[model samples]
Target: MDGIQEFNPFSAGGLDQHNDTTIPISDRSSQPAVLQPSQEPTPKASASAAQVELLRQQEELERKAAELERKEQELHSRGVSMGPENNWPPLPRFFPIKPCFYQDFDEEIPVEHQRVCKMMYYLWMYHCVTLFLNILACLAHFTVDAGHGVDFGLAILWFILFSPAAFICWYRPVYKAFKSDSSFNFFFFFFMFSFQVVVYIIQSVGIPSWGNSGWIYAISVIGTNLAVAVFMMVVAGFFTVSAVLSVILLKMVHGKYRNTGASFQKAQQEFSSGVISNKTFQSAAANAASTAAQSAFQRN
Candidate 1:
């Protein structure tokens, strides 16, 4: 009975022992602990990742800056402007005379002023054509009346001299004024173009022996040769049209100038500054000063 009691499976003590045995092992050296709530991301690791991202952004910005610098250097090396290049006088690549100026109405002129600028360009072209035709008319006049040789020679001289002079003086100044809103250029255009208008009037009047085929000359030849008179009349009509257009354009330009907010003070300031900055002007001034000093010293 004693042995049985000691080994009893249903005894209170034995049941208590079994309950203790069934409890999980406290000393589990081989089993891994449950993934302890994944350790909170370390601040250091997070900082490292952020730094990496920053480095990538910094590298990208540096690359863009380097590329921009490279492009600027390339442009400088090629002697090209960062803005649009000059493509005026769009001559053929093979032409002996390269373009002397750069003109782009769309690029340089304001949208509001482009129409007026284009009209001015057209006027210049018409002026050139008129001069050329005047030469032909004068040749015909000379043919009909041998005494008109002076008229023919003067016509040739006017065509040669006036064509380029008009382009350089009044037309170019107006073009520059519209392009840059330059106060100095505006004033220059006003002064020069006013004179040009007067010249146009005189040309249209066709003073005899003055190298113009104007109304007076045309009427004078009416009884001499009908065909020649008609030819001269046609040329005279062209001169009349040129004069009228010049007057109209001069008025238009004056109106535009009034709207430009350019003052005489501003024009004077620009002129002074331009003269000071011009290398050629500087040299000329220095030479003149030196000469004056020498002359004064010699007089003493």
Candidate 2:
């Protein structure tokens, strides 16, 4: 009987131990469960995603800046003038003609040639003034003697004709040559201006009934009137200076043109174009042909 004895749950120590275990189970059920290490959220993925987004934004901004810069450059290339207007001299309102035929000369003229062009413009102005003064000098002599009337009249005619002619013949051509970088125009201007410089020298020689107050008049008037002689000397000096400067400028222009490959071929091309475009040349050619035909018919 003792060897086969069964365990009793209702006994004092056993029942109390069972009740303690039951209460622990209820208490464990009431408490929150703690998470394992693998279950905890990591901030690494979110942090990496934010970094990538920031980098993408930065790249987009850079791309936009580059695109804007490219657009600005394209605008500039298309003749849209850049830079501040304050950098250039203000245009003169009183002048009958604009400083340059090119609307953007200030921007377009090369840095090397800017001073040269400016000096040329100044010389043109000075030449015009000198011509005007020459006329005045001739009139002054005319007031002294009736025989000087012819000189005064000639001086007036010269001024009226030569001023505009010179602007068209040399000044504009030189401007166009530099502006268009045309070698032909440069050569043409060089030849034309050389002739003009010779004219200046001739005009400077003040003759008795001629318009100029050059060395000739300066020497002739020295004994009679010291003041007139001094004036003639001054005028001759101006003319001499102009001639020298014109020669120097011509040399400089020629050097530049040669460097740009101004050749005989280019000169021929320019000559051909001029001949083709000249109405007077065409008329003369037609007349010559007609005359030749008439002669042939008569001979037959």
Candidate 3:
């Protein structure tokens, strides 16, 4: 009866004892402990294996995203362009098969084409400068000759009329020339500007006037003017006729190539204006170019 009383099963006993000396180290490490509910992430691995599995999945997703970005960059390198116009690496080269067939038929220009083109460019620039000067001269005449009030008024009027015209005829055309690839447009502008120079000269030389006819509808001046006016007029005539002849010759020389610049400009505009097909122009051009390159390589 005494032994039975000493061995009470419900009492705290050896099973509940926490003596480190009696416990196996591996078993102690493996055992679950009473944990505090935490607001913070576990620093020293209180994490359950299930939580570790979730972190692995997140890492996999980020890795996949980086891989996809790398693949996109690779595809981009193969002459595939994005955004409008598909403008990518590899532009067209000049003299792509050098007019070999036309060598015999193509007439050598009597004048050096490059020199003529450059001269015409210089002439157009001069015409613009001359037109601008003409405006200034009229303004000078107006200030100087107040007694000839009608002449002053007429000069001011001429300045207003010609300033905008000169901008359109010379400034805009020069901008176009720089943008253009056509050999003809280059020379065409050069010849046509002579006319503008002539007009400028006539206006500069004569008394303030109402019309192109130098003698008709002339303004009266009280002051004696310099002979510099006459020199201006002669210069104007030379330029005007030169410009006129240039236009005529250009029309004759490049009747067929009139649409060359127009086509290129239209294509560029269509891309910018959101009217072009995504893969039509640049993609096709790339494909054709690459095919040509491949063929060239194979032959070699």
Candidate 4:
């Protein structure tokens, strides 16, 4: 009985031991199945990941290319060139005129002479305004005296003529003088502007029936009519101011010219160049030579 009990096939302890061993084997098999799926990725998922990686690389390449292009453009604008190609005076798009004729003021005008150039330009603008006011003053006078038509007409003519003439005679010459540092242009502008200053003084004098209400009209109309007197006074004041400014500018320009050595030597050279270039002078010289040769031949 004791041996049967010890080797019993229906024992609870033996069944429990067997169940524990079998449970371990089943858990091991389940772990391997779970790990196998994780180790081997699906074909569709791998292909999608590869496509995403290629797209990321393409974007990175494009970004690098754009950065390089931006750097190249920046260098080009600063007068830096790759290879032998250089663009100077980088022209504006849709501009009809060439950049050579209209130089960039900020880049071309020297720092030393910029102030003088600006002052000269301002003077020109002042002159234009003065002329316009003169016309208005003439019209006012015309309203008072219908016979002052001549004054109005002459004022208009002066504006039309002087505007262009001033630009051509003084402004452009001074501009060229500063731009090129030419002694001849400096002398030309000095002489021309000197005459212009004299003209300003004369215009400020306010001659009657002449389109200006200078000091003369301002004083003359004082007791006649207060309103007209005030108007004349205002006009006279404008003229006086214009005259004073013109004188001051003339002095300033003269000082600059002196500093540039626009002396008698430069004047002579300019005059000689002009005479040589003049057709009338050339013709006169030829005639004189011919007459002298005829006299010499006759004497022989």
The model with the greatest lDDT is 1
Distance from true position, residue 129, model 2, in Å?
Answer: 1.2
TM for candidate 1 is 0.70
lDDT of 3 by residue, 178-291 (tens): 344434334444454555556644553453443231321122322244443443344345445545545654453344235334445654554465433566776887899999
TM-score of 3: 0.31
lDDT (tens digit, per residue) of candidate 2 on 73-168: 998889565654432124677755434333345776666666666667777777888778777766666666566688779878878988877877
Query: By the lDDT metric, which is better: model 1 or model 4?
Result: 1
lDDT order, best first, reads 1, 4, 2, 3
Compared with the true structure, what per-residue lDDT tens digits does model 4 show for residues 1-300?
Answer: 656756554698878767755655455654444533467779999999999999999999999999999999999898666654323335666766433334344655677677777788778878888788778766776677687688778888888988878878998788777776678888888889889877778787877766666777556656655676677667677767877877787777677777775677876787789889999999999999999999999999
lDDT of each: 0.89, 0.74, 0.48, 0.75
TM-score versus the correct structure, for each prediction: 0.70, 0.56, 0.31, 0.55
lDDT of 1 at 31: 68
Clashing pairs in 4: 206-214
Model 1 residue runs over 4 Å out of place are 1-85, 283-300
Q: CA shift at 32, candidate 2, in angstroms?
A: 51
The per-residue C-alpha lDDT of model 2 at residue 192 equals 87
In terms of TM-score, which candidate is strongest? Answer: 1
Give every collision pair in model 1: none
- Mark the 10 consecutive residues where model 2 has the least summed lDDT: 81-90
